[model samples]
Target: MSQTNPMPNSNETPTPMAMMQMISSRWVSQPLYVAAELGMNEAFMGKLVDLEMPVIAGGRERTETEYRPLLGAAGFELTNIVPTQTPLSVIESVPV
Candidate 1:
């Protein structure tokens, strides 16, 4: 009689979430890779990067007060402006 191993294969397929995360990470990191290759990352050093946030409150608009403190705590200041028809109910940001 031949002996058989009972452990699962180490090369098992990835789950749906794992696959999605891999794909999304590749998509998001590719640009960064190119930027680094082109020396753009160094050029943008010591600059304030603009961050965007989308706020939707049950089909109603929300005030900056609702998000300012949170962003402030994280070292970001509210821009006090919302883009028109951007699908985002509110946009907030902080300087990194």
Candidate 2:
């Protein structure tokens, strides 16, 4: 015995009612679903290193001001930057 497809043939044109249903459907939901699953503000950073490291490695350090937005994008809020007697500084952040 041969099985039959319930769907209409691909070569056949949809009826006006079917076309209207397609137009009225929520097409934006698919994109919104994907965007929610993968955060819109997700951050990716690479190849950036501190200036104290060798230039042969080929990367540079970013300032505290620059890090604020990056942290926020990754779902954390930058609270403060504390500078010590040494060249290094401490960064504090908490989840939003």
Identify the leading candidate in terms of lDDT: 2
**Candidate 2 CA-lDDT value:** 0.47
TM-score for each model: 0.29, 0.38
What is the TM-score of candidate 1? 0.29
Question: Candidate 2, 39: how far from true, in Å?
Answer: 43
Candidate 1: regions farther than 4 A off: 1-62, 86-92
Q: Across residues 1-96, which tens digit of lDDT does each residue of candidate 1 receive?
A: 432322246487655444334434443233211112233353353231222112223234456786777556544576755453323334545353
Error of 1 at 43 (Å): 42
- The models' CA-based lDDT, in order, is 0.42, 0.47
Candidate 2 — number of clashing residue pairs? 0
